[model samples]
Target: MTVNEPTNHQDLAEAPAATGEVADLLAMLAKQRHFLRFTTRDLTDEQAGLVPTASELCLGGLIKHVASVERGWAAFILEGPSSMPDFTKMTEADFARRADEFKMLPGETLAGVLAEYADVARRTDELVAKLPDLSVSHPLPKAPWFEAGAQWSARRVLMHIVAETAQHAGHADIIRESLDGAKSMG
Candidate 1:
């Protein structure tokens, strides 16, 4: 979609109706994705990788990170936490490799990242739509921030994904503005 395209809410109204909790979750996700898409629109690979802010976050990196996070969470919803990568035991080199997933590293392009983000979103929507129970719970992976024996419902997972995407979308907005004085939203 173009930067001047209608807002996500407006576009969603024209699409098929999404029912219940899935609808709500998808709406929020779509709004965040909208902003993320807007921020990256018309950007070159070089511009996407530019670190214009105090933070290490770049527009393209934010895109890639959000996509990867969403995909992982979706997998967790489908196949439990064991389906996720073990970040706790990652070596220094592993951490470095993971960090590259956020940056527009060699052979990475804005178009490629955006395409992957779209594919992940589509898969997530399909999974959520077909889920029989939003209340199905999965144990969270071992992490310093996670409480021991903690588990999250599928609904909760979807909410977390929405929150994560929205947070990064905001980061992308700031990075985009810093790069070229273009605002994702007023």
Candidate 2:
């Protein structure tokens, strides 16, 4: 879809009618995704990539980062710990290359990032719907930020996703305002 096209979040509106934790999670996810897309509406690629503040983040970069993060978490939920890439094992060059996932690099358009974010949202919703148990647990990936031997239930993961998305959506809003004084929400 074009950057100007409204996102198809009809499912979010119907979420309350659907029973269970998954529906609630999907609703929250949808809300954040909506806000994120709203911030990017009418933006050009150059405008999207503009670093309007002292921070490294830009609108398109935030979009790209959220998509990649959600995709990774969805894979972790579906495929278990083996799905996570071992960051500590990566070479400095590998880290540098992966860091590009967060930025709107040359030739990367805002439309492309929005499309990717939409795809990841669709996949996450599907996964949540099909999951038999929200209480199902998986070992957290080995990371400096995570406690040793920590594990999280699927429900917790969904919550984490919502929190991450909402946090970035806020960041996107601040960046957009700095760009042209346009606010994502009143």
Local distance difference test scores for all models: 0.81, 0.81
Pairs of colliding residues, candidate 1? none
Residue-wise C-alpha lDDT for candidate 1, range 30-79, written one tens digit per residue: 88788777887677889989999888888888889998999999999988
Per-residue lDDT over 5-86 for candidate 2, one digit per residue giving the tens place of the 0 to 100 score: 2453222222323456677788878888888888887788999899989998888888888888888888888887789888
- All candidates' TM-scores? 0.90, 0.90
RMSD of each: 3.6, 4.0
- Poorest 10 consecutive residues by lDDT, candidate 2: 8-17
Any runs in candidate 2 off by more than 4 Å, and if so which? Answer: 1-17
Best by TM-score: 1
Q: How accurate is candidate 2 locally (lDDT)?
A: 0.81
* Model 1 collision count: 0
Clashes of 2: 0
